[model samples]
Target: MKSTDIFLEILGCPSEEMHEPVNAGYICPYTSDRCSKRGHGTNDPFPVCSIWKYTGARENRRKDRPVIVCPKRFYTADIVGDILEHVWVGPYERNKINAVREIKMGKIGNVDMVVCDTSNLPALDNFVSVELQAIDITGTVSDVYTSHLSQTDLIRSPKYNFNTANVHKRYLTQLIKKGYFHSTWRKKIVAVIQDVLFESIRERVRFAATNPKDENTSIVFMSYTLDPTETDEEGYYRLKLKEVVGTEHSVLMNAVVYETPPSKDLFVAAIKRQL
Candidate 1:
């Protein structure tokens, strides 16, 4: 689907754009020959009124520089001293909006970029902790045993401390505190398990004395098994599992639905359509 369609579905309108320019024709550019104030900007050399100034870069301009114009109301404000909203239109524009999140577990740090919708803000608050499991059917533990030896030595290898000051953990915390995740508790739990399993695999790799050179490479393959519901001493509700056997890493990662603000014209049009 077109990104714009997704945008409209989420934000309910087009994305807002600022600083467009409009052309003036066959009249006093300043007031378009309708102004009662003759003294203001009347001496301006440009054919287009100073009030209707072009705000776009030369690259953004059409063949006619006067083609670029901001909203009439925004320009009128310069004379009448009133502020109004502005808008723009382009077919191929890519909206550059996203949410950045960071999560850390002992020695492992993760940064995730989540794209947002222009309409939904509340969805940003929910996420599921995904846990992964390594697929090994040997039962003989030969490969597991070989890897375990190598992992031990690697864990003791020197490592730089990671920076995580800007990471926002509130989203995960709120999801757990609120009940929105209750609907997907089983899925959430499986996700949490995946995280724990990965951490375990990492720890095992660190235990292996062999250095893989780059720390960023994945040492093992893992996958998720969805378990959306859990029942226990605490009354069962949708739950995001937090622990796996013995590990310090938090398996809880949040999933959020995001949105951008609607375009000014689309917003106004919607209001008019309703009225």
Candidate 2:
């Protein structure tokens, strides 16, 4: 591990200016509450929105790549608000649409949020379920976090790897299942994810969503990339929407089930190397 392996891209609320986490806490832009998500064994909220990784010369000479680690990182702006325009259906005004957070359907797993058509008072139908997913880290970085917050140099560098495959194996399955479930209800499901995470899916999963306006599109993915050069008045980097993919529930199912497999001997060759 090297000292440059990890960089905290965001410490507190992504919308606010960077500040020390010792005295006061920064309110989570998503929750509008004290940042509740924490690292292991820490009482106070561990407000790490995202991180930048520097892989050694083998991967690249040296390049800084940002990866969002927290779902709240997607909340610097109303993602669903933007999603509404992309996936909106019916005659209701987009402004009148309400974004509902955290609704659990029996055995379907909890949805992070859903966009509702609030035009009809006391009724919340024609809703679209939304899920926010970030990458799961493969290695520990708490030690790195402690040092960064303390404003001290690392005693020893800690390396962390993004578990992109984990997303494909577990998370994508859940998303497809949820997508199918929503399709049964004749509704739409949207997944908000980072660009890097989506790239991993593009590698392993076959997806070809041509038009967003297609009524057949029951599953929508809106991917964003962190814009380093652009920032709000508070100096927090902007999450620019990079791409939107629209597909049917059945399309997603077939894509995942029929993903192109690698050459048969590729794994065996690697095993031979070990032998």
Candidate 3:
């Protein structure tokens, strides 16, 4: 029933002053301070931590799900605990989890975060990699944000579409390449994302059937959703763990690197039409 919502917070600041500067404070659980990210062309912080998807393609409006646009929003929930249960971290208990951010691997590239057993530090052999991703938005939500700041109603919903294509073209390879490397050490890498993203991925690519419990598995996917019914003292909905599944390097390999192509005749027919 609800539609067109802009979810922004000034942390401990009163709800009435949300549109104004966060005079009281603006602390992020991840950064333990104000959100590190700043909006383009302005020093003002990007106000959208998340938003309710009201207007979009017919298929996208099925549930009016809460879209997690910021990576830090994932930090509000117990995502680490959820990952620990499935990752193949050797002897890394909850207390021993030493999370290092943006650690660079030689050629494979920088991983989002690496969870390690501090007890096994120096060597750092006992660890699992982590990649936290929120879907990239196509159009700017600045219009909606401005409207909220003015406390004026919006005449129309601007295009704030989620860039689902990145799931295949951009992020998929990062997972496969890194997942394969982690597999070599007999460790698992976790892909942390929201439900909307995971659903879009599965629809586009075929997933290989595998269990996270299986020692051979290399990739783990942890999907989450916001619980519309539950809210904290701040009145923001609580994020709940919805599902966790694991796959292997090969499963992800098939996602983009290798795929079945259309028949040659079909290609020729399309070329003929263009000619």
Candidate 4:
């Protein structure tokens, strides 16, 4: 089916076949901006809302424009599957989370959806276990990251959160500490520390959390390489971090760090890399 049709379905709204605009189908003249906002205050007859505006944008825009919607069914299943099947990597998930706020303020980005899951979280005793399980799976990295850290307060405010407890150096210091995860960089590298130096992975992961409630929440991170030939084994997938921003401190930060691996094929060479 067409993407618009799918989007309408995911939203649980009537398709155009209903022969009426979404606003027409509902009672009261709810403008697109007055219906979709999250959270609430004293009920207003019509305070500008977030959800209403988004849905209205979809339902009220020019029909002749190129279809910007993904197949609606994409929303029904786990987001990780869709990411692997579609969407390019690099800050896409982070961008989606940020875009939500932008939408509320009438600012928009290319991000289409925001995802969350609880399996990607790191435990105080077994952070590597979470990381290994995540590496083994093939779904949306953002979903997996959210799942693992579901219990952590960081998820509440991704914009400001990191694995490290400190906010001032949340992104940069922690990035250096994680070795970029699966990367080959030197100098207490952050992300690849799990793969490169397993002994301190726990400390590094925690150091990256911006506001770690328990020792289990992970600061969302990923790794990638610019060399097309670097491949998975060579540590091409870069690390990224995510959390909600403003309300509680979660913020998705992608700093585009550069790292030169000691060896090109580091992560791939480990036969027993499994968690």
lDDT of each: 0.23, 0.75, 0.71, 0.23
> What global local distance difference test value does model 2 have?
0.75
Model 4 residue runs over 4 Å out of place are 1-11, 14-78, 85-275
How many clashes show up per model?
45, 0, 0, 69
lDDT of 1 by residue, 164-186 (tens): 11112332233233222322332
The best-first sequence of candidates by TM-score reads 2, 3, 4, 1
- What does the lDDT read for residue 193 in candidate 1? 19
lDDT of 3 at 30: 49
TM-score of 4: 0.18
Q: Report lDDT (Cα) of residue 137, candidate 2.
A: 85
Model 3 over residues 20-52: C-alpha lDDT tens digits?
544424455445767665655667665456666
Candidate 2 per-residue lDDT, tens place, 102-161, comes to 899779779998888777878777888889999878877888767766556778756678
Scored by TM-score, the top model is 2
lDDT value, residue 125 of candidate 1: 38
Tell me, by lDDT, which candidate is best. 2
User: Which structure is stronger by lDDT: 2 or 3?
Assistant: 2
Residue-wise C-alpha lDDT for candidate 4, range 103-200, written one tens digit per residue: 11022222233332223334211111111100111111232122222322222311111122232243334333332331221111112111112222
Question: Comparing candidate 2 with candidate 4, which one achieves the higher lDDT?
Answer: 2
Decoy 2 TM-score against native: 0.86
